[model samples]
Target: GVTRSHSRPKVSNDNPYSEAHFKTTKYMSDYPERFDSLAHAREWFDAFISYYNHEHRHSGIGLHTPASV
Candidate 1:
């Protein structure tokens, strides 16, 4: 689903965009610091993916949710 950007020469800033998104997920108040079990992790991941795909607005995609995009 990723829209590939025109292939430009690699640079350090290339990673910032993805890294920032990862930081946002990691720093979310509801994100657990630890998971008790595989089941628990799966549950959390499912919920997060649901919200991320259906609700979270991605600025990179013109402020639209991924599901909508």
Candidate 2:
């Protein structure tokens, strides 16, 4: 059960938000340069998601981590 929308009046048109967010994290700001290597990227990404779900403050959740929410 998922729904997404782009610029069309159709049945659940698709937008690329997930891909856009990954690009921002992996390439923008202070992301590591070594992510060009798949193994390194996987390791860092795992660390990031772990911290994200358990440690990071999610503003959209009223400054609570998702685990707390």
Candidate 3:
């Protein structure tokens, strides 16, 4: 197998930040179990985006919302 020097060490975790975000999104109380239609899915996503940007405080950016940042 070809190896790259830029690859992360095997001992280190891969993309922990993204993993955490996925977990948070999946675990939110408002996260729907399923969407009824395309429009409904869009509506749900819009609401989630609003909450994530305006309401959720991201610790990665000094505990500030993405909108504030």
Q: In terms of lDDT, which candidate is strongest?
A: 3
Task: Compose the digit string of candidate 2's lDDT tens values, residues 1-69.
Answer: 777854343336545656444654666455786667889888878877787778878566799988998
Between which residue pairs do clashes occur in model 1?
none
Ranking by TM-score: 1, 3, 2
Q: What RMSD does model 3 have?
A: 7.8
Q: In model 3, what are the clashing residue pairs, if there are any?
A: none
lDDT of 2 at 46: 80
Instruction: Judge candidate 2 against the unseen true structure and give its global Cα lDDT, from 0 to 1.
Output: 0.69
Error of 3 at 18 (Å): 4.0
Query: Which stretch of 10 consecutive residues in model 2 shows the poorest summed lDDT?
Result: 5-14
Once fitted onto the true fold, the runs of candidate 2 whose alpha carbons sit more than 4 angstroms away are 1-30
Candidate 1 similarity to native, TM-score: 0.68
lDDT for 3 in candidate 3 is 75
- Please name the candidate that would achieve the greatest TM-score relative to the true structure: 1
List, in order, the clash count of every candidate structure: 0, 0, 0
User: Residue 53's C-alpha lDDT in candidate 1?
Assistant: 88
